[model samples]
Target: MMIVALMASVSACASTYRVPREEAPPEWREDGKPTGFMPIEGSAKSFPGNHKERGVIMEFAVENERTAIITNTLEWTGPFGGSNIIPAGSPAYARQFSLRMSSNYGSYFGKDMNAYNNPIEWCVPRFDKGDAVCIFWEGSDRARYIDTSGGTPLNASPTSPSGMVGPMPQVQEQAVDFGHQMKIQVIVDTFRSNRITVATRISEGDDWSSLGRTKVMFDEGDTVTLKRFDGEFKLTAHRAGNGEITDVDVEVIKEPKAGRLQTFKDVLEMFMALKAAEAAKAAEDTDESDTASSPEED
Candidate 1:
């Protein structure tokens, strides 16, 4: 009976399982198509003249990967001649500078999706007054936006919008069932001060609606863990103060023995408990052996 009970305990220990980490899908890439005039080029042009002359040129490139080259020439007639190169502050130079800035800035897509040749328009500024330019670059993800102007820089404090630029939180796998508890943890190094909230939602049909929201707070440099166990669902994060949001899609599945969806914490705890139980059993066995070897207490 003891052997059977020990085997059952061992099996239970072995049966302890956790969810595996989910691999986030690659970000979708937007198609890049030409919408405006061809970019400028760096080349020389010859003109009809009495004396042969050559000119030096300078060029500038814009967002569309196009270039615009400007040329300056010098001419001579008699024994000695002087040549002057106009500086950037000059009217001629200013005109070119203004043109380039306007072209590059105006070409930005306001709110209209059609104006943008790129499909990912999240970062694009909605053409309106008080919109400030905001740029976010992560790995291959590049986004530019015009945020609400008049406010301070987004990264003024730890809870500011710029502070969210750090590494993304860790995601855990979940099981699918009607009433089963599904817990998801998003590992973050630091949590914003202005009431950071994490929410879960499902992509029903086309749009995503809310499941619930949880507040996340952590000490300085400590990792913040957010857990949610409810009806099978998807999850996302949102910063209410800055209106920054993260959309994550997750699917729930049910398989006995809890597949790879287990988390590291759960596995570590189980291993530790198993080791402790084994040590206690060994001590008990040694005590029994000593008693059996001893003669009757006389």
Candidate 2:
């Protein structure tokens, strides 16, 4: 009865951005049951190009599968010590060094059912296997980071005037979900008065990169973040006495990119269906319990 709810939820949203089809439905899951994933076999691979060239391009169509795997977030390890590129913090551009957001950091194609085109150009910080991206719809090298602790509908409105979605909760370095396998781990190894050493590793191999150390000097008890270190996660730190600093927080950051885009009518509808499905399941359970414990009339 409650076998594949996640699959149903995603399929509902896909219809909003999904491509119409006349062919037979593709296989769902190995157990002949529906699941919220399509199979993806790829990694965040880089070809050629330096920091400003992007060396990578990413886009996906929800019409392709039930669970959409997309990449809208990009991350870089040390990337040759440090990157000159960072988020512009104005929403006008992705990074201070990039002019790609000409009022459209990302855009939608077609009229009826739209397809998402996220920016992955001039976005690759390193080609030495030190850069990565994350799944938004059609996943890139990895799957996703879903917060299961909260029951908030995925469509819950944010307080932002731009009407962006809610915030993405923070997950530990190597946190893994059921179907979404986290492929990157960014860690802070040494924290001193004036500098911090960072290490980033991918899940597929035993090697780790040393491209992410920060040499910025900070005073004790001062809290700060770096615009240059901004990506899918923010590197936040607090300095301690004697330079033997310890506590460092890496928070997830997500600011939606849009261009010629309107409301997510289809996704909202699907969210409603998901909520309804849960309610139905609860009602069914209650009815069964009532029937089983009912006292027979004399």
What lDDT does each candidate get? Answer: 0.23, 0.26
For each candidate, what TM-score against the reference?
0.17, 0.22
Question: How would you encode candidate 1's per-residue C-alpha lDDT over 201-258 as one tens digit per residue?
Answer: 2221222223233454332332232222221222223343554322222222211111
Superposition TM-score, candidate 1 onto the true structure: 0.17
Model 2 lDDT tens row, 17-99: 11212221221111332212122343322111111111111111111111221123322222123322222220110110001
Q: How well does candidate 2 match the true structure in TM-score terms? A: 0.22
Query: For model 1, where is the 10-residue window of minimal lDDT?
Result: 91-100
- Cα RMSD (Å) per model? 31.7, 22.3
List the pairs of residues colliding in candidate 1: 18-261, 18-262, 19-260, 19-261, 19-262, 20-260, 20-261, 20-262, 40-67, 176-253
